[model samples]
Structure formats: structure tokens, C-alpha cells
Target: PIEVVGLLNDLYTLYDAILRNYDVYKVETIGDTYMVASGLPQRNGSRHAAEIAYMALDILSSVGDFRVRHAPSVPIHIRIGLHSGPCMAGAVGVTRYCLFGDTVNTASRMESTGLPYRIHMSRSTVQALLSLDEGYKIDVRGQTELKGKDVEETYWLVGKAGFPRPLPTPLHIKPV
Candidate 1:
């Protein structure tokens, strides 16, 4: 049990640092579900979506090499999802800031339905990423009905300017 806790802690630490590097804020981490956001607490226009995408890629790549302390041969995997739209953000509690709105919920839906080791995003986020005009490989996942929601166009954030399309997975990663 301790090993599990330690593994999660280390992973969280890694993510916290990575989020900072991308100028994104680590909103919270409930168990294995880590939440992050940008363009809030200080608005940065259309950069939030791209920032998240980059951070997600970095995290997924770094995770490929992150092995458990108890089992050095085993690597960790995570999923990421993004939805770009206006949301209400503020310090909800005494010391905790939070985001509320359809955007936040939709983003959560994207994450919950995402596949491991991949970044699943909505059309709005794809549009936001395109705003920068920096070529990021996006594979069309086509329209799908999300949980409790109508069908919507979804896409996968494959890679960006520096990261290659279909990021390289370690040999340790295998099909389920």
C-alpha cells in the first residue's frame, strides 16, 4: 500500500513541476485524476488549450520513462482531455481555487472517456489549438456520443511542432 501511495505522490510531483513549466496551474489531484488549467487566475487568451496540450504531451512522454520504485520495470500511464470554452473561475474555498461551468464539466467528460496514454479533446479545443497556427497533428476521432450527452466531434492530440506524430511509446508498453 505504501508503494502505491509513494508512486502516486511521485507522479503528482512530476506533474506539478511539468504544469509549472508550461505556465499551467495544477488545479487538484483527486486520486489518479489530476486536474490543471491555464488562462485563469490570469487570463492568457487562446493559449490555454495549447498550453494544456503541450503539458499533457510532456507528461505522457515523461511518464513513459517513470518506473515505480517498488517495481522499477513497470511504467505508469495516464490520459488527458481538453475542452476549450469560457468558464467561471475563482477561489471557491478558503484556500482552494476552482473552475465552474459547462466547460469544466465537458472537460471532465472528455478525460473520463479518454483512453490511456492518449490525449482526447473536443472540437473547441482543436479550434483553439489551430488559432496559434502551429501545426499540431490531430487525428479525427469523428462524432461520438459522450456519456449523458449528444454526439459531438472529438479529436486526438497526436503531436505538435517538436513532438512527432504518434509519440514514440517505450517497448515496455504493450497492447491490452
Candidate 2:
């Protein structure tokens, strides 16, 4: 229905702006699946991981105000997954841009295993964040199975240094 389209548009619109602030890139949004990336096209060093992490937190918190035109009372939830690694990206057929690699696949797994209203991340992503700063709050999610990959540890991104934890986000994700 048109209402669903409106909901998707509204969510994307909000997320896109927040991503821009963090210098993250919105690769595409297929239905409700929105894909994003950083440190690509032009490299930003390891900070790409941090940028994506902060952007994900921002977008997830924004969901608190997001309303579906069809159901304003229904709360919206989003699951964000982050993996830091290499990938091949470029505009493909029909000029549609794409990122292809196991990195993308593993990132997808992080999201699939993630719960609503949370930002799930791989250990690699955590390492990248720690490399840049020690102030990002993270919670251990323990080992999770990824398709084509053995069981691996994962985590939830709670908050970042110097930034107010997202408000009314239930968990209110604060630093530990």
C-alpha cells in the first residue's frame, strides 16, 4: 500500500540525513533493507568503521520519533550490522552501485542475528573502533553463527564518547 511506501520513505529520509552528517554513504534501500558503507570510493582510514558505528546509533535512535502514516502508535525498530574489512565496489549493470565480498555477507549476518532496536557488530568492527577511541560503549553478545563462517563473537554498540546517549531509546544506550 501507499502507506508502507510512506513509512519506508520517511525512515530513509531521516537515516540519509544522519548518515550524511557522519560522512557515511547510503548504498541502497531495497524494500525495508537499507544498506550503507564508509571508507569507500575515497578512503578515510580506519575511521570509516567509527563513522558507520556512530551513524548506525543515530539512525536507530531516530526510530523513536518515526511514525508510520498508517499506524502512529506502532513503534518502529531497526537492526544495524557492521563489519570492517575489504570489499570490491563499483557501479554495476543499470548503473546500480554495489559492494561485493564476504565482508558484506558477514555484515548481513550480523543484522540477521541482531535484535530490533539494536546495533549489532562483529569483533572486527569493535577492534576498529577501539583502535580509534576507548570511549565507545559496547556490550558483548557472545558467539553467533554466521552462514559459511564458524561461530564468532559479536557485540552491541551502546554509545559513543562525548555524545549524549540516544534519548527515549528504551535502553537509552549509555556508556558502561
Candidate 3:
């Protein structure tokens, strides 16, 4: 639908801005799906988990006010999944960069099985974040079978450990 397309455009623009504030890199996007990673190209230690977590939370907050162009009454929602691990990165053809490994697959599963407007994270990612900063608020989502992988623990990133504050206004690009 035209509305879905417009929503995606808006999201991509917002994502572009969000990406600038973090050390993460945008891997790729297929349709409505957007993939990103940190500690890649150059490793940043446990900080990658925190950076990704912040970006995910910012995205969730931004999407809350995002309206579909064709159907303003309809709300847009996205499910995000995060996994921290090693992966192989290389260029495929021309300027196309690709990431291949079980980490990517597991992260995809986290998103596929996650609830809309929420950030689902794997145990490794949570541990990484906690190790860096215990100020992150996360809740366990329990064990679930993730396709080829057996049941594994999952978590939901709620917010920073402290009191919630109003998020700054997100940059919106008017449709051309």
C-alpha cells in the first residue's frame, strides 16, 4: 500500500539520523526490515551493545508519533532484535556489503518472534550491555525456540535504569 511505502520512507529517514548518533553501521534493508550492527569494521568493545540499545529505544520512541501518509489513522509499529557476537563481513558485488553468520540469523529470529514496538535482545547482547552499563533497564522475555536453534533466553529493553525523561523531537522529512 502507498501508506506502507510512505511509512517506510519516513522510517528510513529517521534511521539515518539515529545512525549518526551511534557507532553502529547500517548493514542493509529488505523491504520494511532494517539491519544494523556495532563493533564491526572497528571493534568498540562492550559499548556496541549500549549504542545499539540506545538506537533501538530512540527508534521505538520516534515511531510512536509516525503516521501513515495514506492512512493517518493507522499507527506504524516495528519489532527490533539485537544479538552480540562475531560475524564475517565482506563485499558481495560492486559496493554491496554483506554479513554472514549465525549471529545474523539469531538476531533475525529475535525480531521475527518479537512483539511490535518492542526491542528483543539475546542473552549475549544483554550481558554485554550490563557489563558496560548497569543503568540499562531490561526484562527477561523467557526461553523460546528460534528456528534451527533450540530454546534460548530473550530479553526486552525497557529503558535506562533511571527515571524516564521526554525524548527530543525526531527529525521528520516532508514527503517530496
TM-score of each: 0.89, 0.90, 0.88
CA error at residue 110 for candidate 2, angstroms? 0.6
After superposition on all CA atoms, how large is the RMSD of candidate 1? 3.0
Task: Please estimate how well model 3 matches the true structure, expressed as its whole-model Cα lDDT.
Answer: 0.82
Off-target runs (Cα >4 Å) in candidate 2 are 93-95, 165-176
Clashes of 3: 0
Misplaced by over 4 Å in model 1 are 164-176
What is each predicted model's overall lDDT from 0 to 1? Answer: 0.81, 0.83, 0.82
List of clashing residue pairs for candidate 1 = none
Alpha-carbon shift of residue 152 in model 2 (angstroms): 0.7
lDDT of 1 by residue, 1-176 (tens): 89889999998888877777886887787888888888877888788887888888888888877878899987575778888888888887698998888888899988877777778899989988988888877998777668778889899887888674345452333322
Whole-model lDDT, model 2: 0.83
Query: Tens-digit lDDT track for model 3 on 1-176?
Result: 77677778887998898799899989899998899999886789778898899888887877787777777887675788999998889988997778999999999999987877778899999999888865888898787778899989899888886534443332332212
> Which regions of candidate 3 deviate over 4 angstroms?
162-176
